[model samples]
Target: MIAHSVDDPLYYLHNFRQVLLWVEQRYADLLDPHELAFMQAFAGLDAPAQALMVRMVMRKGELFRSDRLEYTEIGDTCSALQSLEALGWVREPEQLSLEQLFALLRKDELASGFAGLLSRPRAAKSDLLSQLQALAPAPRPLSEWFAQAPVRIVQWCLQPLCDRMRLLFFGNLYQDWSEFVLADLGLLRFEQVPFSPGSRALQQRSEVDLALALHQCAERLEQGERPGSIVQALAGWHSDNPWLARRHGRLLFALGQQCERLGEWDLALAVYAQSSHAQARIRQVRVLERSERWQQAHALAVQLAEAPANPLEVQALQRVLPRLVRKLGGPAQPRRRARPAPVIELELPREHAALGVEEAVRQHLAQAGGEVHYVENTLFNSLFGLLCWDAIFAPVPGAFFNPFQAAPQDLHDCDFQARRAAQFDACLGRLDDGTHHQAILDRYAAKQGLQSPFVFWPMLSDALLTQALACLPAAHLKHCFLRLLQDIRNNRAGMPDLIQFWPEQGLYRMVEVKGPGDRLQDNQLRWLEFCAEHGLPVAVCHVRWSEAA
Candidate 1:
């Protein structure tokens, strides 16, 4: 694991280029003549321009806010956009600034719910258009245009056709991409660095240059490319910084995983030894066993079985551990971690297309006025939170970001941790003063104008806030808040659903509604146990439908 510098935009751009170039070749025959012609023209473009096109298409697809493509920052204003327009496969309104662009979008209904932005205010005046025209004489970046306006601008770029194309061709890559981008040193947060020498140098060496190159080697090993090239390049990566080395560990793990998949046992073991990835130890044991190093594999397997650090790793290792133990003539007793006690999961059986169980629960809660909200993961993960750690971060300056995934590469960075703690403290102060309720609601309202599901959930009402505050213990708040502060991606789930708040009595209970046979998922079970431990009011309501006789 090499400790590369943090300002590595090339790392992301490398990936951006690789995916496009690979797709262009892989899907060549599938392209219509016009699409083929388009690719040819795309191929003719210089690397920077090509990367820009891919970035736009990869992010927003064929359709997006025209303003986002305008790059007046570096003589890039609308030139690349015009080239795409020349392809006739791309499109935009006559204007680039959103005042006119959104107006155009709304007039045509090009984007669903985009009209909502037309209705959002600016400085207490009517909608943002008039305010935008007044604030700046010309169209700039959407973020700048709406600098004073209260509306979400980040989601304005969307490509409908390109999105479908991705789902059609690259479905398997989606999870892998998410896994990579959602991690600490992944592409998403690392590319936010502005155009500069430092960014340019690393941007060229993106994940594709590193990880994808290794992937291609593993994939085509039989077809002739030497794994030695990859090993040589990997071994050459050197860094004294432990933080950077940890970041590179992911890259090493990716290579080891590929080697293991390709049946390169010795190479896989060598790669795994240097990696501190969660599954690295178990993976090494597998390779060692495959090589018939029975004694060494047995010793490592015994140590892992006795005390595994990663649950998923243990689950995977357990399947093979018993066999290895028997061969080694070891005792059958495995010192497994104690499992959580069972919580009976209730289910509500379907009633043949009648009112759905969820709707029925909603109606039941509504009977008493402001009793229940069907706030699932979408709401709890988004609206109810004080800080939007999911979309925003305040780590040390010069930290890069991924334009694709909405979070940073490494939330675990010591600098990020310290800054996030301070940010969280500020949010807590607002919460105590009752200011956070409205501030959070305002964030939701601002996002209402955008094209994201995160903004469209049930509104965070004042009554809900008051009732929630009454029932929520400080410890629970601290736990959840700190979890979000630390890692928004993993900690966002596991929340109880259908929180029924009684504003009259300033009380609430988390009601998990289920049909006659539905079961609790691991995350749901975790929530129930947390509630149980915390002494919070929670119930798993089960509904049984009568026969239609």
Candidate 2:
């Protein structure tokens, strides 16, 4: 489950009980009496009501309008709302006076769509207030206000608990909807996993050749005539006699994909046509259709549908051929042939240059330091690895623990936040007691099934961990975790690019390497400020523009 698509819904929901139990056991001491009662009440609710509470935590304030509660498929929300109110966990907003209602209405402009509701002339505010107040029920006494024990208890039990849970399932708690969808979940675990010699070779071939092609000839490709120099370099090769071998072919496909991304269909078609994969042919049919060569496209579609190279190709053919056949009636043409086309000059996006920046900085920083972890987030990730695991997987159901996934349950009912205070307090205690680092190392090393990204033992030397722990004390580390929980959506990046550690002298300095004219982003500024406040050693080293090229 750890290695599967991080987007898998089951991967997260299945861990519900485990996540709950893990925190309960680990952070038992942090729960005060009221908080304990609130958690017990939470556990006793019907699944839908429990899920409704979990969903409410991601939203601001405990109060939600009846309509704002989402994912209605989970269960009867009205019933859940009733259960919550009966338990004294939620409040029904007061039915107020017309004047009060009108005052609330003015919080936003009467929207264009709703202006009709207030189109007629209205009574004066003073008269309306008097009239509405007389008919309104008398205001409740202070005893009703004092009767909100459930509200008080849940706030203590759920806020920190959910925040911690949000950190586990989503390292960035306040991330907007899109960020959650597009997020690279592996960052919490591994961004740079150990690659095999073959994969490394392929990766090197892909990134370097593409970088070199764009860096060296990109300007000329954009300014020059048709057949960008990069594509022209491979112009002589064909599907049957592809002179561009494996590594070069890898680079070729990457450039074609780049052209396709930049909306250069002609260049993409020209480039992909030289590759042997059926996908290249499948892609070309669309380009042909775009160019109005229906007969040629239909022929190729038929060819592919009859004998698709892979399962993906078969699916692709099925999706395209129905429309393609309608175009086939236009003309009869030679079967099993693709149109010959020329590649055009291609432009690179701004980020294309950044591909080479890491290598450039790495080479420059290679000198002087005894060893550089380029530690960035990895160090912090490893330090908090075990706690983060508890956040997501919640390993409470002892015998049911699967090497693959957490115990499955209704996603909405995953009580992510209840034990938050205790678990985090335990993390701070373990780190201070000098047992935290070893525990992370011991568990990660012993469990072959473990895939948590925070286990930095494999990446860093033990001496480095000793130095990192010394530099990152428990209080400072806790402050950082809380900040991450608050800003994970936007603060994932902006860590200093490199750190040079001199183990021989037991010294290290966090360095932000900027390639000329680059300024620190907002998130980076926050981190730098945090470091400055804590007296941690850090520096900003801007690479001279003269050396940039």
lDDT per residue for candidate 2 within 1-549, as digits (tens), equals 233244554333224444455445544444456656766787888877776765665456543446556454456777876787787667655433343334433323223212333332254545444544555535532234233311211221256545443333331233432343233244433222222222111122233233334333433444543445577765554332111143244445566666766778778777777654335677787777766777877788888778765434554566566666666654433343222111112223335346555445554556645556566666765666554555434432221112222221111121222324465566556666877667656655554334553344566666666666544556666666655544343343566766666655656667776664677765566667667766656777655433223
Model 2, residue 142: C-alpha shift (Å):
68
Poorly placed runs, candidate 1 (over 4 Å): 1-229, 240-247, 263-266, 276-354, 364-370, 383-385, 388-391, 395-405, 411-421, 424-471, 485-488, 513-518, 541-545
Q: What lDDT would candidate 2 get against the real structure?
A: 0.50
- Candidate 1 on 350-380: residue-level lDDT in tens? 4532777767766766775767877666545
- TM-scores, all candidates, are 0.49, 0.33
Query: Best-fitting candidate, measured by TM-score?
Result: 1
lDDT of each: 0.52, 0.50
Worst 10 residues of 2 by lDDT: 407-416
Model 1, residue 539: distance off in Å is 3.8
Clashes of each: 22, 10
Clashing residue pairs for model 2: 14-407, 14-408, 18-394, 19-394, 51-412, 161-417, 161-420, 162-417, 172-488, 189-453
Error of 2 at 310 (Å): 50
